[model samples]
Target: MAEVKLFGAWGSPYCCRIEVALKLKGVEYEFIDEDVHNKKSPSLLKYNPVHKKVPVLVHNGKPICESLVILEYIDETWEEGPSLLPKDPYERAMVRFWTKFLDEKCMPAMRKACLSRGEEQERAKEESTELLKFLEGTVSGKKFFGGDNIGMVDIVANFISYWFIIGQELVGLQVLTKEKFPKLGEWMDEYLNTIIIKENLPPKDKLTAMFQARFEAAATATATAAAAGGGGGGGGAPK
Candidate 1:
């Protein structure tokens, strides 16, 4: 029997991605839920000292950090299950490419849109929508980003199907919509309805509440900072 353990947060989409992969691969892992909003655990720190983040996969006592990296590791390590990456080199390359675009480009812009206000928020929303257009086109006529079935890109893009939609609603930012990206919306519906994904998703109500509280706290902190800056700057013009 293999010793497999995962340190992750219940509300995190990153963690959910790993869990989905593990389940898809029929790998049983001990899940250690971490309170990422507060202090992290010593074990998590020990595994990923640099990021000190959740979704760390510890297999046979060796820790693998980062969700994407861990996803690849799981796919390679377990040969019994359905392959996450395609067998063809070109197809695999495309998968990696889109996944990179999602994490490096789409995710950040969507998050910024959610967290910012005014011009900044508008800019981020526009950027996110533009980024999503590419995905919309890519997934056109395809049931999943992986084509026909769920694959690496589909797993990596799990955030778009659930987390980002919830986030956009909470912050009153509408970056992704069915009307704007019909193909992508259809893909989301199909992907989320899959047995593996549907069963493993975080409870919608719980996730919504968590995101609501987080957005509220961020807004409060931003207001407090602005008020403090307003009071201080009037008294001094760089004295």
Candidate 2:
């Protein structure tokens, strides 16, 4: 058996993506939760020298950085069950296109919603709505992004399903609603109902409490820093 290890964080949706992909593939690997904010471990630095990001997968002592890259590597390595990428070249390219789009467009809106304030927060909300609209339009009739079974693009896009709900509460905004985005709302239900996804999700109550506390703490810190005349500005909100 190859020695597989994963460096991740508990509350990060990015980390959850890798965990879900690994579970869906039924791959056995040791999970090492890293303190991404506080202090990263020596091994995490050694493995991911470039980005120093979490969700780094080490297979047979070789490191794969970035969640999407790691997911692709995992799918290619373990070719037993469901395949992540489509067999058809055109379809595969389409999936890659959407995955990259989600990372670039959708993800930035989420980040802005998480950390921004005042006018920045309003701008983030507008951008987030546009992205959600695009997603709803795209997934109108598709069973999954891959057409049937879940695929790499679906895995990457799945973050919006669960994490968006938490963001709704944390950011004090409602981006997704059954009335507004009915098709996407139904798609979220289908995605969550999948046994593999449902089984691997973090506890809801626990996650809610975690996010709520984090938001409150950040708010308090921001207020305190402002009162102290300290400089801590810029960057979009959390997702």
State each model's CA lDDT, in order: 0.85, 0.81
C-alpha lDDT of residue 66 in model 2: 92
Clashing pairs in 2: 111-237, 112-237, 114-237, 114-238, 115-237, 115-238, 116-237
* Alpha carbon deviation, residue 7, candidate 2 (Å): 1.1
Best by TM-score: 1
Instruction: In angstroms, give how far residue 51 of model 2 lies from its true place.
Output: 1.6
By TM-score, how accurate is candidate 1? 0.93
- For candidate 2, the C-alpha RMSD (Å) to the true structure equals 2.3
TM-score of decoy 2: 0.90
